[model samples]
Each structure stands twice: as C-alpha cells, then as structure tokens.
Target: MKPKAPNVHEDGLLEYLEDIIGYKEKQNQLKDKLSERKKNMLKQNKITKILKINMENLLKIIRIATIFRGERTIRFDEQDLIDLKEELSRLERFLEIEENELKAIQESLKDMR
Candidate 1:
C-alpha cells in the first residue's frame, strides 16, 4: 500500500521550514565571516610581532654604531655613515609611530577593563 501524505497544519509549516532554512543559511554565512576575520587577525598579529622585533634590532644596531663611533678614531666610509644615518632616521620615525599606536591600544584596553 502507498504511504499517505503528511497532514497539513494550520500553523503554516511550509513557511516555518523556509524561515528555518533561511536562518541556517544566515548562520553559516556568519560563521564563515567570523572564521575569515579570525585568520586575518592572526596574520596581522604575526606581522605586528615581526615589526616590533625588527624595531628592537634596529635600535640595538644604532646604539652599537654610536658606541663604535665614540670609541674608535678610525675613519668610516662616508657612504656607510650616510646610509646608517638614513636608516636610523627611518627607524626612529617608525618607532615613534609604533609607540604611539601601542599607547593607544593600551589605553583602549584600559578603558575596556
């Protein structure tokens, strides 16, 4: 014998099914968006860490060069000195920007707390 069809309900089951499907699709979309955002945040964190390390190394190099300049009477190549000076200036500017951003982040964290 053939099976009977499902009985129709007054509660509009078909509309409820459509709403459920729509809500599931929206939830899946939101999950995908959240995962993408998390990946981007991790990538940005790694880049920020690398930049901080590079800035620290640049500062150390500048300090060592300054110390050498003070200790030795040996004449350095003019081009080398000029290049070092330019690099130091660039690093200083970057450090200043990073410092400001770090302070801003700290302040934001404090506010959140």
Candidate 2:
C-alpha cells in the first residue's frame, strides 16, 4: 500500500517548529549585540579614565612650569607654554568624545531593558 500523506495536524506542527527556530535565531542575534555593546562601553570607560589622568598630569606640569618662570636660573619660553596648552586642548576634546560615546551606549542598554 502507498504511504499516507501528511495530515493537517502534521503540517501545523511543522509550521510551529519553523516559527520556533526563527524566534531562537532572533534571540541569539540580540544576545550577540548586547555582548558587543557591553564590551564597547567598558573599553570606552577605560579610555576616558586614561585620558583624564593624562590631562591632570599635563596640568600639573603646566603649573610647575609657571612656578619656575620667574627664576633667573630657570627659564620657560612662551612657545613652550603654547605647545603645552595646545596638547591639553586636544586631550580634552578626545575625552569629551569618548564620554559622549559611552553615554550613548549606556542609553541603548537601558532601552533594551
């Protein structure tokens, strides 16, 4: 005898299985995205912290340079001060950008909740 064709209930079960598979794929994709975002946030935070420390050290150097500017034994040129100030400005801008990016990633994580 010939084998029987798939009944309606079997077809319905197959559709349900397919749908479950699709949902599982979507869930995995979202998890991957969340993991990547968390890594980026961590990296950004580290970069921001390092930048702040460097900026603080630069400020200290500038202060010390100013203190020695009046001595007849030690002299600091105007061009040297200008160069230090320019470097400080660049670091500040870089830190600001990193902070803003970190905030954006945090906001996205919140929205995912």
For each candidate in turn, the TM-score is 0.48, 0.50
Taking the tens digit of each residue's C-alpha lDDT, what string does model 1 give over 67-86?
88785322454354456566
lDDT of each: 0.57, 0.61
Name the best candidate (by TM-score).
Answer: 2
- lDDT of candidate 2 vs native? 0.61
Best by lDDT, which number?
2
Candidate 1, number of clashes: 0
How well does candidate 1 score on lDDT at residue 6? 50
Superposed on all Cα atoms, the candidates' RMSDs to the truth, in angstroms, are 11.6, 8.8
